[model samples]
Target chain A: MLAFIIRRLAQSVLVMLFVALIAFIVFRYVGDPITAMVGVETRLEDQEIMRERLGLNDPVIVQFLRFIGNAMRGEFGISYRLQQPVTELILSRLPATLELAFASATIALVFGLVLGVYTALRPRSFGSAIIMAASLVGVSLPTFLIGIALIYIFAVELGWFPSFGRGQVVDLGSWRTGLLTESGIRSIILPAITLSLFQLTLIMRLVRAEMLEVLRTEYIRFAKARGLTQRAINFGHALKNTLVPVITITGLQLGSVIAFAIVTETVFQWPGVGSLFIVSVQVVDVPVMAAYLMFIALVFVLINLIVDILYYVVDPRLRVDGGGAGK
Target chain B: MTEPLLSVRNLAVEFPTRHGILTAVQDISFDIMPGEVLGMVGESGAGKSMTGAAIIGLIEPPGRIARGEIWLRDQRIDNLPPEKMRKIRGRHIGMIFQDPLTSLNPLYRISDQLIETIRTHLPVSRDEARKRAVKLLDDVGIPDASRRIDDYPHQFSGGMRQRVVIALALCAGPELVIADEPTTALDVSVQAQIIEVMKELCAEHGAAIMLVTHDMGVIAEAADRVAVMYAGRLAEIGPVRDVIKDARHPYSQGLMGAIPRLGESLERLVHIPGSMPRLNAVPPGCPFNPRCPKVFDKCRTHRPATSEIEPGRRAACWLYPGVTEA
Candidate 1:
């Protein structure tokens, strides 16, 4: 088991290295950092001095090594647009994006699993048919459009929620969160729903398909014949079998929820890193962009690693070689 | 006369497809006496397994028991609601499915699967269920049952896994167990061992077994009575020895002859010529008529209903004067 975990950790390191390389390449070539860093009034010689001071003249490998070294120390220089250390900038915005991502992901997972299993167990029922048809909207509509429509309905016409921004936030140490406040909770409802819609549908459909498939398996029939209750057969035996693939898909979707928070963040004007990355993009703030890329990659790699571990925990077949084969 | 532990009266299973309703098992009736292993033998599509499924009420949708009555003793189970029938299944009529590799849930430990089923049907504590499960496993010939109980299904080989499956079926000590092709997916060497373990354990538990298989050897060894089905209809049913040695129905005779005898050598094994008819394409009369070597004019025009040919034997064949014309 330890060896398995170590092997997975090694694979994650390689993935992160590749992502780091991509982030470095994107930062290096996308725009002139010096132009963005200085004003139009600055002299060319002064600009050269600043560029030299920043080690811009160094070879690609050296600069890349320097970037990797700095990244390891949790440094990403300064965001040119915000005039703040990129790490600190991201850290400040981290709480918002993380909260939204987690909220939406929780919504997506809980509702998706329940609805998926329900639809699978009662595929012919009227409620299942309606739920299935409604899920198509989630699959078809773009995130931005969903967010906009939600705002128009709940914020503009209904006057039930604020149209944009995190309403009010409380500080828990350095972390700022709207979760504890009423207005803040209300404010998150629209964006979170919009962010969750696409993933929820994907998860629901995948789970329903998987559940249906599992229910038809010989084990399920055997379970039924064993006189297990409908609840035990469906949830205990059938649902547990469906979760291996579901966990893999849900993990990937979770990474995407954070990465794609940009659209929902922009539409709702939520004070999250996605919006920060966008503003940095317009101004060519390479440090923040590179940091954002690295952060997203880290989330994905971490999630993949966690999912791999979960596979070992959930499925005994995978663990037999590592743990049971010895016995 | 001993009361039948299970009785089926005019059971007909049908599948409704786009074209028409196809009868999978038609006019099937039989009785399983208490603690007796009744082997159901047939070809791949002969509806042997379908009969087993119908008794347990596990028939898949669009296909159902269109007309039938299944009685567990005198309980009249066929007409029972699904919930009531479910209660009877594990506690009264347990089932062991084909493919032991797939019958046990791969995600669960053998203990969890066993204990869960035990507690579901029997009033027992977790620890009590665990103890019973281990004992049942040991009875089924799984070595080191207590230690191995915690291991998942994949830890065991095919034969060991089947022993676990047998243990699972008899865990709640049900009166009857429907074993559907239990050894078909196993190694040829392991087949006899599985059958032996199943029969012995079921005997110890006093559980009657409805063994469904096409293997006549298994029936001869383990079954007390044998019922031969041909194309969704019963061709013959009698004591295992009588059916194997002096089969009354032509199809059963052909089936018994097809088995190569140990001492006698032949150029080719006696094989029935035509395949069992598809459910939709079954002819108007006796399902076995076209393939029967003794096909006659009456057989082409009329179906033969199951009727007593001997004091304790039955055959559905036109040649048997006692068989009522359908």
Candidate 2:
């Protein structure tokens, strides 16, 4: 088992390297960040100096190799727009974005999983019908539309919060000031709720479908006949086997969660990397945009690696590293 | 004779369809004696398994035991709530299904599954459960029973897994064992091995058994008394020797004729004339009227009750030598 984990971890490194390489290529070749934002008064000489300073004048292959080398050593260089170190900007803004993402996914997972299991248990009852209908509405509406819909009702009509913008994190950064502050937590609710709606639908549907299929299996019948308690049968026997794909859904959806957060933060002005990335894009700050894009992609790669590793913890069958041994 | 252990009287199973309540098992009655092997023989969808599952209170919803009483020893168990019935299921009545490969959980070790059964009703310590698991495995003829207890279901062969299932059923020390086509999923040769092992195990434990199967030869070899089902009703039942050699019901006779003898011509072997009637649209009178060779006007219009043919043998047929005079 340790050998299997080691092999998987090694593969995770290869995936991360491949991802970082693609991000570097796409940041440079796809669109010219130089033309989109620089001032007209900036001299050709000054531009050349900027190019040399950021290493843009270097060979593309050489630049990519250096970037990977630096990343391996934990240096992300400096951001062109903020005139700050890239790692510092990402680290400072990362917590807020991560906070929103984690809260939203957690809410979705707990709520959706419960609703899904409840529906699957009853199958065709009235409660299940309502859950199915709710799931339909949850999935059918696109994320941006849901975000807009929420903004209209919760922010505009209800006037429950500041329309946009995260309240200053400085005061809250200190526990002396931030403890259960009305402004700190209230600011995050709409964004978290907006992000959770879509993931909830995805997770709920997946869990319900997997649970239904597992319930029909002979082992389920055996469990019932084994004198194991009902709680044991449903959760211990049924849900335990259904967890592999739950982890997969959680991991896969984290990417979409971040992506959806981009639009959500843009709409709500949540103090996160998503809104920060958008600003860097509109102004075409090449270094900052490159840093942001690369960071998001790396986050995705790492999440998937974690998910792959967790598959072993969920089902022992996949832990083995060989062909199926016939009894 | 001592009172029979289980008495299922006028048992009928039905499902509510769009048209109406369609009866599946129609007025079947039989008794299971303590320390005896009663073979339940029928074709697929013959209600053999429905009887087994129903007797254990595991019948799926919508399909209910419409009219009947299932007595265990002296207690009527048919109408009890699921929670109440669950206590009796693994404690007093044990079961083994046909698919050994799937009947045990893939996620659990054989020891874990068996230990769970032992601990559910008995408050034995983990060590005691572990010790019992090893003994049960050994009793079922598994080699390296102590070490192999930690092995998963997939780690064993088809026949071996069946033995594990039998061991699990007997782990709780129930008085009656219901082996529902326990060897049907095994190779023909392996099937014989499973039957022999089950017979010895149940006899050793002094537990009566209801062996549900479709194999006539298997019933002949394994059963003490035989209950022959047609569609969903018990058409004929008697001591295994009498049921096979002197079957009174035409349906039972037709079933015996269907099995080809080793020395007999395969081409000349007889087959039942037509399929059993669909549940939703059973024939107006007899459920098997369309296929009964001895069908008469009365047989087509009114169903025959299970009248005793001799002191202990009974069959639901108008043609039983002194049967259905009414």
Candidate 3:
């Protein structure tokens, strides 16, 4: 297991390096960061001085190598627009984004599992049909549209939740944001629901499909023949078997959730890395943009690594050393 | 005579498809007395397995018991609510399927599966159930049962897994076990071993068994009485020796003749002329009429009801209409 984890970590590092290189090339070609920073009216000589100072005057390969060397030491160059270290800028927004991601994930997982299992158990019922139709709407409709609709219903008309922005956040020492606070939680409710809508439906559909398949398996019939209660057979035998695939999809979806959060954050004006990413992109802040790309890529790789480890933990078939011994 | 442990009265299982309702098992009836092993032998798709499934209350959906009744010791079980039926399943009657690999849950240990079954039906604590599970494994001929109890289903060989499945079926000490082609998926060499284990264990537990298979040899060795099904109906049912030696139904005769015998240099094995009919297009009268050599005008127009051919023996054929005495 240790060897497997170490091997995965090595692969993750290689993946991150590849992502960094791609981001560097893509950002460089997209636009001139110097022009975006200084505006169109800046003098040509002033732009030249600014370019030379930021190492844009160096060869592409030399500039990339220099960026790599600095990145290796945890030094992402200062953001041209913000005049702060790119790492510091991302770090400052990390807690807010983390809180949002965690909240949305919890909501998605809890509701998805419950609804998925319920619908699967009573597949022919009217309630299941209604839930399935709702989930389809959740999957098909755009997240931004859902965010706006939520704001209109709960914030604008109902006056239940704040329409925009993170309500007053309390810094609970060492970069932790206390979501336990009433304002912090209430502020995030609309955004979190908006962010997780798609993922919740995806998870629900995946779990339902998997459960239906597993419930038909011969072992489940055997479990039924064993006179296990309906609850025991559905939850204990059928649900456990469904989880391996569900967990795999859930992990992959989590990465997409973080990636897609940019839209929800923009709609709600939540001060998170996603909003920072949008701001940095508009100004062409190459350092912050590249670092953001690399960070998200690293997150994806790490999430995949964790999923692999989880597979080993959940499925004994994968844990056995030499294959073909067990069926 | 003592009341039969299980009684099926004109059971008919039907499946509703896009075309119409197709009958899988049509008006079939049988009885299993306590401690008796009744072997149900038939060609593939002849509804032998469906009979067992219906008896166990596990006929898959889109298919259901369309007619008649199933009684377990006077309790009418054919139309019981699912919850009530579930309580009787592993407690009063256990089921073993063809593939041992698919019968046991791969994620669970053999002991856990066995103990769970035992505890579900019996008022035993976990520790007590665990002990009984280990003993069941030992009884089913697993070596070092106590140690192997913790092993998952995949860890065992195909034959060993079938044995574990048999042990699982017997865990709750059920009075009747519906073993649907239990040894069909096993190797020929190990088939006898499994049959031996099942017969010995069933005898010890005094459990009635409905052993469904197509193998005549297995029926000869393990069954006291044999039921011959042909195309969704019972063609013949009698003592194993009677059915094997003097089959009254022409279909059973053809089945017995098809079995290759030992030390007899026959020119060739007998082959039945036609295959069993599909459910969608089964003949209006007797299902076996098209395949039987002796099929006549009456056979093509009227379905034969099961009638006594001799003492303790019955067959569904027009030829035996007047044979009331043994």
Highest-DockQ candidate: 1
- Model 3 C-alpha lDDT per residue in residues A241-318, reported as the tens digit of each score: 999999988998888778778999999999999999999878778888888888899789989999999998877666
Model 2 lDDT tens row, A170-288: 44452222114577577777888888998998898899999998899888887777566788789877897777778898898987787558888887778788888888777666666
Candidate 2 residues lying further than 4 Å off, grouped into runs, are: A148-163, A168-182, A321-327, B265-268
Worst ten in a row by lDDT for model 1 chain B? B317-326
For model 2, residues B86-160, the per-residue Cα lDDT tens digits are 878778888888899889877777888888888987889999999988998998899888888887777788899
TM-score of each: 0.98, 0.93, 0.95
Cα miss at A75, model 2 (Å)? 3.8
Could you tell me how far off, in angstroms, the CA of residue B25 lies in candidate 3 after the best superposition? 1.8
Clash pairs, candidate 2, are none
TM-score of chain A of 2: 0.89
The i-RMS of candidate 1 is 1.8
lDDT of candidate 2 at residue A283, scale 0 to 100: 67
The lDDT for every candidate, in the order shown, is 0.92, 0.81, 0.89
> In model 3, which residue pairs have backbone atoms overlapping below 3 Å?
none
Q: Which candidate, 1 or 3, has the higher DockQ?
A: 1
DockQ of all models, two decimals each = 0.71, 0.48, 0.56
